[model samples]
Target chain A: MNYPNGQKKQINQQNKSVKTNNNIFSNRGMSLEEDINTTNTYYLETDIAIIHKKPTPVQIVKVNYPRRSAAMITEGYFKQASTTDYNGLYRHRYIDFEAKETKNKTLFPLANIHDHQIRHMEKIVKHGGISFIIIRFAAYDETYFIPAEKLFPHWHDKLNGGRKSISYEKIKEEGHIIPFHYQARVNYIKIIDRLYFH
Target chain B: MNYPNGQKKQINQQNKSVKTNNNIFSNRGMSLEEDINTTNTYYLETDIAIIHKKPTPVQIVKVNYPRRSAAMITEGYFKQASTTDYNGLYRHRYIDFEAKETKNKTLFPLANIHDHQIRHMEKIVKHGGISFIIIRFAAYDETYFIPAEKLFPHWHDKLNGGRKSISYEKIKEEGHIIPFHYQARVNYIKIIDRLYFH
Candidate 1:
């Protein structure tokens, strides 16, 4: 059975899993980005939210427009993003967040996030938008939602010659654990509801 | 005089204009995108609003890791954007909009916007976000902000075998004219202030 253009890749992936006899659990080893993307798709389809991950920023320096083919980017470089990754509207509220996963068992380093992104989140919170970060402990298979307000004091401490990272235990204490659902794998919206709504 | 990396382009453009003796006005022939970017920067600096044009989406096919320099995208194709060109939080409201400039003197063609973008804008409006489109008539140097609600009727008409374009006069009557300012070039936030905040 042949699939259309967009569905082809998905069908091929499933086939590969089937060939490996790994069909029982489809999302066993999915990356954090893939899980969030799948969760976002489910949210959009169910009309629960309209969150979207912004595309990776690239600076195009050269292009090759063949006579019959699409315009191909021949030279490009990645640029530092000026804002958070995921943002949209949920329950009539502006929602913005960045998601990161760390393989370390003890701590999540502050260096994973950039300075300008922290400033951007501060502005978002000041403007009354709901801003947060999703931190995933890959070793423990646990994800936590930490509000921008909660992360700021730690960032300031690091700037003032304090610890360079947030301990896993500290995150477990301060952050809300995001439960995984089959459809909404990351399921950060549940945490948003608890934080922002009643 | 040596300029920083990002400042080099602006300095070069200014020097070119000076050499040609066309330095009376720096923004005489700027595109709508450039104007809006400048306006957003001004708004950000003044702490008035937070808006940003999302980066152009590209489907990267291949990349190369050089010995000492940056990773280069050797092959890629532009992807159709799934949402509006710009979205951000303003005065606690989620602001979303698409900007387009046309050389057509009498009408703005509906083909410039995609079906998915229209659906995206509709979802935004239904979710209580402020959604609109910025239509610029380059021939007359006039830009108008048409609310998503106002555009829906015209889009439906086109879908029902009616006129394929919205007349310039119709847009002028239905849309708010965005005033030009020296710093905030497009200045759509002024129109937003009147439409929503008031």
Candidate 2:
């Protein structure tokens, strides 16, 4: 409930929408990004870890400065990010990851990720950082944490004219289910603890 | 010279300005941010590190989506960053730092850095991540890598109504001068090697 300025507005909007829809289980209606952001905030407040969702990239073309008000961007376009969505320090380890949720129950499409992002994740892993992807099957209400190393083979296969998506069965076999908590909604760090720390 | 899209445009603008000013020492003309970015690109290309400068944060207030056109931000405001400007993996460690340049030769003023950034750096150090500030004395043509630990005392002093700035002589004694090079222009990793890896 103690979200920061910009995030507070977003949570309030979501709450309003949930009320309008009369959704009894409002917690389950949160998007993956919102859940992760809340989880990161909880980790930051408790001094457990420091992770953040990088701001959406924007290419500003024009701005106007009023007499006293803050400079306003009058013209800008969204830019495709060259790196993953989230990254920060966790348990003295450099952590980086991308989160994607799909309505399709059968597969997670590779088109959701860019080639540069795949290469970035590759470099992160090679440099001894913890890298992964959080895949949410919205239809099943399940989120999986798949390590970067586990993902590379599938990405390579796609590049070599193989299946362009990872099957749900394959993901379930290779990935760890991220537990949902009241505070740390998408508790991916718990998976990291089991995989790397312990 | 292999700068990315937005950065290439900026470098071109800087080059044009330098030419107009007839500043012969063009290498020294680059801003602290540009130098660090170039150095980071070099490190990434050479597979030495995976550090990156986070994109400038912006808060979007309005957007226009014309048919068959990319969505444009019609109204936006710059947002204060919650963390340091630069952060990523370096030598299997979490690297986070802020870069600042001052024209004053006598001392580096404390006002250039925000209080929250100081707190963020403090937390980074506590979590065993590598945290520091890259300070450029534009008047002296020197860039120094001041460890977060070394900076805490001065920041605390400012909080306690002590000197509002750290003098140039004190910085010379406590901070390591980041060597300038053709590829790794700022060459901050050299200082990290000497201080941490050695």
Candidate 3:
């Protein structure tokens, strides 16, 4: 079926299952971002939550006003984000967080996060928002929801000349494992529902 | 005087007064956006609120990575926003809003708002977020805070064979007039506090 904009129905496979394709399907299925987008779409459709990954910020240096229609940016540069990439209102509360995927199976490096992002998360926390980080170990096919509260201590330790990364064991111990759901792939909100709201 | 970024101590005049240079200072003052940003900064500094204007969204088509320190976006376009430009956490409540300025003094044409923005505001209201529009009549030097609850009705009316523009009288009657403070220029949050929190 073709729509006006060639819009196709999104294949939101909540459950990790497909026909005649086990390992091959699982490996090529979805990225961490795709999973979260699918999950956010489900939450929005069901009136459970409303969250969105903000559009990538761009600084346009030049634009052309081609007669009729919207203006076109001819020259631009991607600006370093001063805050996290995702934020929204959930259950009448502000929810803000960042997501990262690393192939390393042993640890999630602190270098994955920037100093300004840490400051932004801290501000969110201080202002009574639910803040967290979603760290996915792509090598192990595991994802963890590490709350800002759990991760801040490790971040603060850097000032005291500490380890620059959180060991995988530490993440598993401190963070809640987000299980994949049939209707909501990479259901981090399930962990949030259990940890924060409960 | 020059403290790195021309930083100066903000004088948050809650009652909107300072000295003899009333009209003079007001004429040579900051824009609505600058006021909001400075206000957000003050709020962050004083631990009052944590809101930010999401960076402008740009769609990058091509990038030149010439083994340099940064990549330059060679082809890009400014994308229309699917959601409001500013959002944040305020007193544990999710707050989101869009700002617009018009030189017209009478009616605010519905053309200024897109269909997607109306839909986005509807979702925010449904999801229990405080959503609003800051309509500044630059000609009249007046700013009004129109809540989603009120604006959505007018938006829906347009779809139901109603007027495509909202008259100035109607807006002033329904919307709360936002007073311009010295530091917090467009103090729409004051109206938010009264309507949502109070």
Candidate 4:
């Protein structure tokens, strides 16, 4: 399928062992990450907002200074970020969020997010900034914009002997459904406008 | 010298040819950066703020998958960041800024800051966030927290065929002088609280 962004969405092959929801339109190859990136780029290119996905943090252990120029990192490790994958200014407000994709149709596991990330989000919310998660049920090719408030309960519940994951049905009912667009594939900001701006 | 952070300040060797102000007590080995990093860490541990310096952005060109584990990047290049060095949430507002040090005591060169970074700061300011530069005049061992508003005129001057830098005398008059603290060496946030909160 061709998106308004003028890019053709490549359908990805599915595994027979996993449950597939054929009812929803699947734009498989363009992962949830790619969609969000594309959306952010569009947002930036237009001057709507100055949002950016932070570069994957790397801890450089060793570097080689071959000349009086840019030092080349020789040894490094992909440092697990203490914060979210993306954060930037939106509508004059601080915005922070994480995006994840799961094949499971019934549940979105809390394990996909790190403990530090939860704390980071909690701080943003406490400070009155916006925090959220973008989850893609890849099997069904559906995505949802769920605020941090909806997510915090699931994290706390794990300790209270509650379900370790949020049921898809619960999320569908509580979360804002992100519509797929031709240009802005996962246009999550539309929901933000309604939730916060209005 | 032992700082209030309970750490010894490591003095960096100075280039003799460069300008040095002997009257200002120089923590010779401890660069301005080390002080700021130490301060930030202290802030985080004390639950003051969750600010962080974004890792230097690097572009990975080649990677080697030696085993079924971590991918080792064999080739990469440092990418100039379009945004500033540090940013985070402060009192429910987005804070973004850059830090620069200069040996020249008379002036803070406009060349040190990029054009895009100025634009980035402008956007942050326009969106109700705080944006500024923490300029450390090494010779004087003096740092100034100048808001984007104060810095913008200097940027615009260059385009109008005016002088391309801000003189130290002018900066001293216009900027908030950041006092050197034992623990929070670059306590720029104190100025923020004064300027924004008060």
lDDT of candidates 1 onward, in order:
0.91, 0.90, 0.82, 0.83
Judge the docking of candidate 1 as incorrect, acceptable, medium or high: medium
Q: Which prediction has more favorable lDDT, 2 or 4?
A: 2
* DockQ per candidate, 2 decimals: 0.67, 0.68, 0.59, 0.44
Q: Which stretches in model 2 have alpha-carbon errors above 4 Å? A: A1-27, B1-26
Q: fnat, candidate 1?
A: 0.80
Taking all chains together, each candidate's TM-score versus the true structure is 0.88, 0.88, 0.86, 0.84
lDDT of 4 by residue, B61-109 (tens): 6667877788777666678998998888888789899999999979988
List clashing residue pairs in candidate 2.
Answer: none
**What TM-score results for chain B in every one of the models?**
0.87, 0.87, 0.84, 0.84
- Highest DockQ: give the candidate number: 2
Model 3 interface CAPRI class: medium
lDDT of 4 by residue, A64-93 (tens): 788878778777667788889888888878
Give the CAPRI class of candidate 2. medium
Worst 10 residues of 1 chain A by lDDT: A18-27
For model 2, what is the alpha-carbon lDDT of residue B79?
98
Contacts from the true interface found in each model, as a fraction, amount to: 0.80, 0.86, 0.83, 0.44
Candidate 3 lDDT by residue in tens digits, B1-198? 122342223322323433334443452345668767877887777777888898877777888886855777877777778788889988888999988887788999998899988888898888788999988888777889999899988988999999999999999999999876666777777998899878
TM-score for chain A of every candidate model? 0.87, 0.87, 0.85, 0.84
